[model samples]
Target: MLEFALLVTALMFGGTTLYSFGFAAFVFTALPAETAGPLIRRAFPYFYLFVLATSAVAAILLIARDPISSASMGVIAVTTVFARQVLMPAINAATDSGDKSRFKRLHTLSVVITLAHIGCAAFVIIRLAGQS
Candidate 1:
């Protein structure tokens, strides 16, 4: 159980890091904003879903052995729901409506939330790892 939890938590960290730094960065650099923008918008949903599923699973797995890690994962899972369902649509609407300021603010919030999720996943991994 511990090993499986660690693996899932690592997947959470790696997925976020890769999507945020690797895929998102590469897409923007390799493609123009007009092209990259829509592509990233499409890709983000999957990213959020990944965060949600993995964190939820990890939370369930860690609940008995490590409440702290489980709680962190739970927070990540819950925040991801808001990010995916409410926040993402708002960002898209802001962009579609040409509300640049609103888009920027919302997009920044999304980025921060994702980064914090990454931190939480990392923390959980570190904490759980020390158990063995």
Candidate 2:
């Protein structure tokens, strides 16, 4: 029962991370610069605040629950790293674009971060599946 609960929690966290990433990517890539300009300008403050809130809450939950097993820890670690190191940077880069070179550099960094995030998620998911 406890294992099942832990698995469910892990899956939920993983899904949340994926969902957030998907939304950010879609907003960044699909929306045109002009179209996204106002939207991003208006939304960024709220979005960042929300991200911070979520991160704090998640950290509290993880610390409290303190996943005893290795697999659980892996899931938490991967998701947390991806959120902080990858997704946040990607979103920031996507929102702030001024110069061509700056945009190019940020875009490249975002891609790299995204790919790393996906790889980490895949690895964690596979590990979780193997445990089941």
C-alpha RMSD of each candidate structure in angstroms: 0.6, 5.9
Worst 10 residues of 2 by lDDT: 64-73
lDDT of 2 by residue, 25-64 (tens): 5776889967765665565445434434443443344443
- Stretches > 4 Å off in candidate 2: 1-32, 38-97
Q: Could you say which candidate leads in lDDT?
A: 1
lDDT of 1 at 107: 92
| Candidate 1 structure quality by residue, lDDT tens digits, 1-132 | 989999999999999999999999999999999999999999999999999999999999999999989999999999999999999999999999999999999999999998999888988988988997
- Supply candidate 2's per-residue lDDT for 100: 58
For all predicted structures, in order, the TM-scores are 0.98, 0.45
